[model samples]
Structures are given as structure tokens and as C-alpha cells.
Target: MRRSVELEIITEALSKMGPHTPATRLWGRAPDATADMAAEGNVWAGDVHDVALHIVTRLYGRPGTPREASPLAQAEDAKRRRDMGDEIAALTGAHDQLTSAPWYPARPGDLVHVHYEQAGDLPPFGETYIVGHVGAGLMSLQLLAHTLPETVPGLDAEATAAMAGCFAAEAADCPVYEAWFEAGPRSLTIVRDGRPVHIGGAP
Candidate 1:
């Protein structure tokens, strides 16, 4: 059976479950079993129902399975829905805000100063980072050279880069900075010497 045909069958069957069915739940079933079947080149055979059942078993487990026995299962469904709701809200609100903001086409040597709060338990402090690789939606940055404090000691470039990446992802949730990305040019506010600066005269 061709892959396209198999997909068509799966789509038709799943469509019967209604349009609002979560795609993740539909695809989350029996991933390993599907892969094994595919390795044998027989995934699109007459076992589509079996493969789908495998997926449902993985997601919801066997019928009559005791949920009260496990502490972790107590609030799993509620938590999953809540987390999914939060994710959808962020993607719709913050993501939309970012993609629609003013943008400038980033260059190879462009400098970006990212203002982010430090992680973990410590006095709240902001640090500056230098941008490295820049894309329309994402930018990689690292700590500025010669900016490390003597007290920190042994913080190498690799560690700094890793930390910067974490901070950048976290900073996306920050309301103070109206930074987001879309298809064309990258959008972010660049600050220098305690003042806002524009690149290529972008407002």
C-alpha cells in the first residue's frame, strides 16, 4: 500500500470522530508499533484498526485500568487540558503580537542587546547579551566577551551560549518586551548605552 493511500484511510477513519478531535491524541498511539510495521513495509496493510487501537491503548491505557492506584493519574486529565489551554493562549496572543510588530531585516553582523532576568533563586538582575545567528523568527545570542565577573569564575563560552539560549526562550513570554517574529524580517528592540537604537533606520 502506498503511504498516501494509508494516510487517506487514516484521515477518513479519524474524520468520523469529528473535527474537534485533538490531532496529537490521534497520532500519539502506538508510535513504536507503527514504526516497526513500516520497517517491514506493511504499515498500510489491513491492520490500520489494530495500529489505531495500539495508539489509543498507549494514550488512554487498557479498559478497566485502575486510575486510583496511581498518584500521578489523579489529576492528569485536568492538568493536560489546562496546559494545552495555556499553550493555545500563548500561541494565539503572544505569538500573534510578535509576528505583527515592527521588524527590521537582520544582517550577519548586526548587534542585538537582549535584556532578560536571571534564572533561579537570586536577586532580580538584568543582563545584556550579544546576538549571533539571526533568523526571521529566532535569534541565537551569547554573553558579551570581557563581561564576565571574577566572582562567577570558570564560566566558559559554551556555558554562556547555553544559558543565553534558555534566557531567549523564556524572554519570549515577557510582557515588558514586545518582541516576536513572523515570515519576513526579524523584529526586536536593540538597546545601546542605556538608550534605544535603530538598525538601518527602522522605527
Candidate 2:
């Protein structure tokens, strides 16, 4: 029997919570900013947990006079590390909170469930893949397109790869995988009878 679509999403979200991460505040370091975006995932310790990761990518040195990419890169690196550290903390906190949170008694029709262990700091770029399965031989693939109107936004191919891997079971027997794979990011592929059907580019 195939897993429910909501279960798949919950599992997918939970899988993101990496090892050594806290269960409380699993949605990164700044709970307010991250969880507030989606009300479903905000119940750490029966309250809103602090979820903002302290971006610290500036330890190497201060910004240069010109403030070029080199200095910016350094700052970014530091921030990434800090974010990672904050993620770890969230994992722990979530663990403690889960003991009392309603997550354990989760019921059906819950579209927005947060996994305590797999939470990580929201990436600077890249879109979150929201998977939807409509039974009767069709699963809809939704991509939360991330882009900038002013500038070309960056994409994390590796992260996309990871998210794609999770859809293997549905894609294994669907024809949509080929078309979706060819079109690339911000695209959707539906799998039916092991065939992936090209949906369209993400908005």
C-alpha cells in the first residue's frame, strides 16, 4: 500500500531534520519568522519557539572598504555556520517540546505538520518542493518557485536533487519523470502508472 500524500509530506519534512538537531524549534533558529510563514508547524513547547538562526558568516574579518563579493562570501560563510549551529539547537529544543506537543497525536487531514528532527535553517535560495498526491493514478508535483523580480535568483541543484529523490516511488512507474527531469527546476512532473507527465513551469 502506498503512503498517504500528507504522510509523505510530513515524512519529507521530518527527514529534513538532521541528526544532532533539536526537536523544539525544528524550523530553524528564528521560530517567529519561519513558523509564522506557516501556522501549522508552530507549536514548540506550546508556544512559538525562537526560530531565527544567527547568521554569522563574518568571522574571518570585517567587510572591506569596497564591500565586494569576496568579503560578502566570507560573511555568508560565517552566517551559514551560525545558521547550522542554530539548527542544531532547534533540533534539541523540538525534541523536548515534542514530548508534550500535539504532534504526537497527529490526525489525518493535517497538511502542515513539522518534523522535529529534520529541521534546518531556511536556505537563502532555492524553492521548497511541496508534493501532492491525488489518488486514482495521478500525483501532482508542486514547486514553490523562488525568484527575484529585480535580479536573477540562485538555485541549489543539489538540494533539488535531494527533494527529487524523495519522489522516487511515485516517479518509478510514472512517465512524468522524464519530462520533468528534462525541463529542470521550477517545473512539475506528475507520475501516473509509472509514467511522468509534464505539468508546467513553477510560478
Candidate 3:
């Protein structure tokens, strides 16, 4: 499965190479050595909770400077960010769209449907939740729907593996997000409005 996903990513990324070279069409951080991708079985997450880690092609990002900070770090940072360009753009657009929607800045007791973009079939996709607390740019949501890993349609073992990948960053509110081997619910917060978020009314 790891080899398959890696091949898919490499193949798809290389195809888009053309004259416009990409930092890497595939997002997420891997070991510096390409061999580690296989040796360490890094493509798939060990836990069932991380969907993005299961799929190597999952698009996601963390907010902050690049990991490297040496003299050449500037260039490296630019390159790394380029790999995540799509994610950043999507996030910026999500902020714009959500802020404009009736549900923007969701309030406590408000019911809203949060959409999971590009999640294929193995993710939470979209689910209903009651808004909890909102502060410091992080809005707490208490899931209203009875959504368990199994309850999510099409979330089989392989698909479950794809969904379990850790896409969290250092900016994450909790430390569990920092470990790659540790699986969590963290994911690419960016989403496209036009990809069409199937929404529900706020109560």
C-alpha cells in the first residue's frame, strides 16, 4: 500500500512537472532521504484516525516558518512553501468564504456543517456539529452527528488508513499533533468553496 501510494504521488507529481517545476506537487513532510519513504513505511499512518496520512496525495499545511533554519533556510523555506502553495491558497480562500457565509465565525449553540475538502471517500467528508466555543481563531465544535470511524461511509481498512495520516503542524493546539507516528484528527484546514461544500442551515 505504501509503495502504491508513493508511486501514485511520484507519478502524478512528475507528470505536472512540465516547464513549471514544482517544489513537489505532493505535500507533507518526509525524511530527507527518498529511501526513507519506503524503508520507514512513511506513506501510511499506523492509526485509524488519521485520514490524510493514509493517502500520500492528501493536501495539507501548517502555519509557520519552514522546518529548516540554516543560512540556506530562506531558499529552502520558499521551496517547501511552494510544495504547500495549493494548501495555503485553499486556506486563504476558505477564510474568505467562511467569513462571508451566515455561519462564518460560528457561535456556540449554532449548528453548522463543516466540509472536509478533497477527502475522497474515506474521510469525515462533511458532518453536522453544534458550534461550541470560538476564540483565538480556533472554533470549538461538538459533533452533533453520530460519526464514528466505522459510521463514515466507505471508510474501510485501506480507506481508513488513508484517512488516518497526520497532517498537523507545530501551530496545532495540542502536542499530540506534533508527532508524525502519533495519529490524531488534525488535517488540512484549507478547503475550496467551489469544490462545493454540501452545507446545512444554522439553527
Candidate 4:
């Protein structure tokens, strides 16, 4: 009943089947072979086929033999491997795309604008920021100016509340907002009201 014993039985059964020419020898023929060689190849093929069928019948048709994992388990394992392969392929594709993309010129003191909905309000507002640093896939920006009014037609109490609420929500879920607040200017992309803004001759 042990797995080793079962394997040994299978091995012994196969060995008793007798050695004849392997299927590989059938293809090892010269261009100008005799009829005898062709007949020998056909005989080898038949022998190999019969041996293969016997092995299959012995493994599956007999009772009281250790069976491999169920078909469902095998299928699930195959699916997991396929899913992992897909994930790896997707990551590789993204990496290749990023590597092949055109470079954008960005640097310190470069002016850029960002826009997002003000908290508690539907209308979005824009803010201008000065780039503090730039690196691969990131740009740090310092707040240079905001739409908040310090003078005439400046942001009222309701507007200020809306802006704060908007930013607060964005800070929680938006990468751009998180970068602005937490990372202090590193971002994957820069946008103004959902539109991409090019800086420093970036196309």
C-alpha cells in the first residue's frame, strides 16, 4: 500500500515488457536506406506503441493500486500556475512599456499645475506648484500658489470647507494627492482637472 511499493511494482512491470528498439531509433535513418531499414522502423514503431499501451493499462485498469491526485486537484494546480504566469507577464509588459516610454524633461523650480475636487464641493480647483525635485516616475512639487483668495473674490468659508474636504478625500485614495501631501511632490503623473499637463518641453 506504500507509495514506494507501488512505484516499484510499476517499474518492474515495465522492465518485464522487454527491450526492443526505442521509438527514437526510427528517425535515425539516412536519406538512401534499404527496404530492410524501412521495415525495421515500422516494426519499432509498433513495438513502442504496444509497450506504451500496456503501461497505461497496467497503471489505470488494475485495482488496489495507488492513484495520483484527482483530476480536479490537478486542474486547480494548473490554473494557479497559469494565473501566476499571467501576473508575471503583465508585470513584465508594464516594465517594458515604462522603460520604452519617452523621457520628459523636469527639474527643480519648474512650474506645474494640479487640479482636484475641493472637499464637499463638486467643482474642482487648480493650484500651481514649483517642482522641488524630479526623478524617475516621481516629481516633488512645492506649493507656490493656490486659488484661495487673500483679497477680492477670495475663497469664502464654504469654498474653503469644500476645498479642504476635497483634498482630504483625495489624500486618502488618490496617488497624486498622497504624493503631494505624504511624499511632498513625488508623483507618477501630473494632471490639471483630469487633463495631463506637460512641463519642461515634455510631450
Best of the two (1, 4) by lDDT = 4
lDDT of 2 at 126: 28
lDDT of model 2 at residue 33?
50
Worst 10 residues of 1 by lDDT: 178-187
Clashing pairs in 4: 118-166, 119-162, 119-165, 119-166, 139-185, 140-185, 141-185, 149-154
lDDT of each residue in 1-203, candidate 1, tens digit only: 11232244554576456365433333332444654454544433334455555543333232233221111232244367776643444344434433443543333333454333333432223334454444444555444432323333356656644443333332122222332322111123455444555431132
Give the higher-TM-score candidate: 2 or 4: 4
TM-score attained by model 1? 0.31
TM-score of 3: 0.28
* All candidates in order of lDDT, best leading: 4, 1, 3, 2
lDDT of candidate 4? 0.40
C-alpha TM-scores of all predictions: 0.31, 0.19, 0.28, 0.26
Give the range where candidate 3 is weakest over 10 consecutive residues by summed lDDT.
Answer: 175-184
Please report how far candidate 3 places residue 12 from its true position, in Å: 37
- The per-candidate count of clashes, in order, stands at 3, 39, 8, 8
Q: Residue-wise lDDT of candidate 3 within 19-123, one digit each (tens)?
A: 655423333335564644665545433221133233322322222222212212222454677745544443343334334544334344444333343445444
State the lDDT of candidate 2 residue by residue for 1-203, as single tens digits.
32223233443445456564433335343346563464544443311122211111121111122221222233345467887543444333333323343332212121221111121443333232334555664544344443312222253655544443232224222322322323221233233333333222211
Best by TM-score: 1
